[model samples]
Target: MSITRRGFLGASLAAAMDGWQPAAAAGARVTLDQLQPGVYVARAHNAEVARANAGEVVPTLVHVTGAGVLVVDPGPQAAWGGALLGAIRALTPQPVRWVVNTHAHPENVLANAALARLRPRPVFLASAATAALMRQRCADCLARLQAQLGRAAMRGTTIVLPEPALQAGGWLHTGATAWQVQVHDNAHSASDTVLYAPQLRLLCAGGLAYQERVPEMQEASLQGWRQALRQLAALPADTVVATAPGTPAQTLVPTLAYLDALASGIGAALAAGCDASHAIDAVAAAPFRRWRHFHARHPLNVQRAWRQLEDLWMQGEPLA
Candidate 1:
């Protein structure tokens, strides 16, 4: 029998309340590489989410603090989150005190289910907009991930909404470490939260920066994203963590180039009287065709950019 979305979510929540366990049979493992003395990152495979990768296509950031550990973007599934928690325990005995979801993407936030099992549960945090988006979309996202990766891989996963929304320009303190939160709306997703650790000169840029990966633009605003990137580029960060792998300074380069090309190509297409249907072909893809997921995601990016630019044009607003 087909289960309704509400029914599926309700069942998942019931399972979670009954002390769900990670699906160890799925063979998910987490490995960490030190970015600094106390900063580390688990780099996800730079590819689309699949059963083979277990939907683990987004990087997870870990900050070891004197008080406890702070985890950013836990992961895509409960099993992966359990593995990540184990990896952290191996490195430090301090409990995870804070869990930060940089955005509302499934791959970035669903892991909170496993992490929620902590004895002294970590304070889950995200922007107000992100929390709202999660409330609206996470159930469907969870169901989709399960369908894509199989129930075994996503077993025990459930949606866990973040609490105490983080405000832009506010400071998040844990132990001696402080992260300046930067919030952007209508950019990467409906809301994007960036964290900068001044002491470590490290920046967790969420989906605002992609490393050699073609960004998904389904919920993006081309102009807003570019503006947010510009603001991020001005920060004094020595290391940047994002969705894919890249060096500090070069982390944002490919994303910027892709967005710039997308905007200009779409604008020109609009000026030439191309509608959404033809705009995809009109936008040049040669420069970014080699990027990961280019073929799968770039065409959609072109369509989204065309629509946004066309809307602006209709209102007599410059499509810059």
Candidate 2:
């Protein structure tokens, strides 16, 4: 039986509400930096997720509009979300009218439960695929995070799936401010959502772009991600909100360079008949070792790229 969006969200919410408890007070602090008149970004650490960071290693974006507020990627857990809400309140008294989850990753969406506490709860949205993935995986993702960060750190964190899936080419408007939603599938994740505000010349490329940090490849498509980066580069955006610290113009550069080197190295290894076991070591990691979490994430990226390339080769697709 096919499940409709409303039915799916209703069922998910019903289940989530059964054991729902008020989230513990926010322990992590979120500070917003104005990117544009109505746009702001709270940058996260470029290191790996752990108990110290409280899994708060993803940026949170806030856009204040004449009608209300719109938040993107609330945060890692309920406390982080609560901290984010407090940060937003410091800027404006406007109610948060919309909450957009750019993807299904727990670091980005689990905070939805905390944000739901807002008066006249904000409408939560994500791409259809993202919502589906959240339903399928967020419970495990939440549990895993709790284990990694400890129960006290992840207190009150729960899976909160977005509803009324957003679509590409759709425009989200709040009075004078507007955002053009663009969805790229099989790139950074199963589905990635990017927001472009023409008036502000800003692009919020969620998980598609990272800066000063090795890109995570657990659920990424190297080829597809490269294509998405190309598309983003061609945009007229003056600022790109990425995972690490860097100028907006240079936001996609580091990630693009890393991806290119990874793909080329893997392709060369395949051409040399190197097995997957040796392929990880064969990739040139010297250049990226200086990047944050390089030791932890680069080898995994190489393995993932090698597997993907092997599958493509089996289908007779030429490596680019």
Tens-place lDDT digits, model 2, residues 1-320: 11111101123332333434334443567778777687787767766688888888887888889788899888888877766766666677677889998988888888897878655678999888888888899989999988998888788776777895689999878668778989999998999998888887788898888877789899899999998998888888888875653455566877887898887887888888888888777777787788887888888888889889899977988877
* Model 2 misplacement above 4 A: 1-26
Cα RMSD (Å) per model? 7.0, 7.8
Per-model TM values vs. the true structure: 0.90, 0.88
Model 1, TM vs. native: 0.90
Residues 1-320, candidate 1: write the lDDT tens digits: 11111111123333433555567687777777788888888857877788788888887998889899999999999888877776676677787889999998899999999888876778999988889889999999999998999998888898899985799999999899989999999888889999988888888998888876798888899999988888888878888898864555577766877788887888887788777878777767787777888888887788778888888988988766
The alpha-carbon deviation from the true structure for residue 40 of candidate 1, after best TM-score superposition, in angstroms, is 0.7
Whole-model lDDT, model 2:
0.78
Best by lDDT: 1
Q: Pick the candidate with the highest TM-score.
A: 1
